[model samples]
Target: MPEPHLLAADTDRAAVVTRLDESLADGRLTLAEYEDRSARAHAARTYGELADLTADLPLPARREPARREPARSPVASALHGGAWHGAWGHDLRAAWTGWVTTAVIVVGIWLVTVLGSGDLQYPWPVWVIGPWGVVLLARTIGERRSQDTDRQQLPA
Candidate 1:
């Protein structure tokens, strides 16, 4: 008959494998580390050995503790100090494209309006069309860039 502890350990192995898998998915453990640790966990024949594998992981840290302290980066400090802060992380090319498109649409609408009626009036088409198109294009570009970065990081 199998020892009760051995049976319990075998059952607990599934939980350990689950935890290891989650860590691997979240990038906390590299692929190699995950495979090695998973193999060790699977080979463990006793509850004590399984427990030992998880002994080093701390309980999750509280988010409140992190939020209580103000961020100390120079950029953050400058923002807090009332310095003129431009939009951080904005792609200038994206912004320029958006502005240019907006301008073009506005001009096109103005021309249409002038040809239809000889009056300077706000163009609704410019407001409706330009911003969304530019935003979509920028998001597509950003997604591709992020994918490229991920591909580069993967072990060749």
Candidate 2:
């Protein structure tokens, strides 16, 4: 490793800014502190100056490269949809839950209105539910297509 007192490169400054941003997002630092540190990082001229801003923070975690597996069991593949799908599944599940919750609430309100009027009204809740469901479906399809494209481009 180089000496901390040495002049810093643009990359070094950028790294410090990224750390400050992460700290702010994780509630480790207040917005004011993050702004101050970020500005200092951009103006930093030496490695020591940049290091000082993040001295109290823990080191960032290092990510290991993804290891491609040759095959998955039929059940595992069906449940998880291979590697990329498994990674995106959690996010999709959350979005699906949100949609379901909203749909139930909207339908409940519509039912209450119909009972109060003593007549079946036009299903206005469908206007809210239909477009949202379509958008979610489109997003899922788009992501699946993107993952397929990525898998095809991978080295065999």
Candidate 3:
């Protein structure tokens, strides 16, 4: 550790002030005591002076590292849990349901036009379906690859 007589940086002063704030919040220090200590903390010129401000206070509790979870796209969350968590298949099914529903609606419209005109209309629904299907297929492929990668990462 560096010598306590060494000059303190703004960060050192700020750390001491933060502890003073916490002490005040916890009712360990009255407002007058906090104001005095905080003013002294900002004016402190050495690590030793800063340390004196909190020397009698208990150490702050250690904070746990936050847990990591898989990142999900907005579309994926809507499918998996944003609408309702754990009641459906993972994001995959929800993603496809949208494309399938739209495809059915567009095809039904095309069929109606063909019947009314008594002639084959150009298969127009393919315009709506094809690109969307390709996108969903690509997303499915990526999702599968990620699942495979996750499975491999697990210990045998």
Q: What is the lDDT of residue 10 in candidate 2?
A: 93
Candidate 1 vs candidate 2: the lDDT winner is: 2
Extract clashing residue pairs from model 1.
none
RMSD (CA, Å), each prediction: 18.5, 13.5, 21.5
TM-score for each predicted model, relative to the true structure: 0.34, 0.42, 0.43
Report how far residue 6 has shifted in candidate 2, in Å.
53
Model 3 residue runs over 4 Å out of place are 1-90
In TM-score terms, candidate 3 sits at 0.43
**Superior candidate under lDDT, 2 versus 3:** 2
After superposition, candidate 1 runs with Cα above 4 Å error: 1-9, 60-156
TM-score of 1: 0.34
Candidate 2 positional error at 58, Å: 25
For TM-score, the strongest prediction is: 3
The lDDT of each candidate is 0.63, 0.80, 0.78
Residue by residue across 88-154, what tens digits does model 1's lDDT show? 2234444444455566767786788888897777667666666766766666566567567769999
| Cand. 3 Cα-lDDT | 0.78
Clashing residue pairs, backbone N/CA/C < 3 A, model 3? none
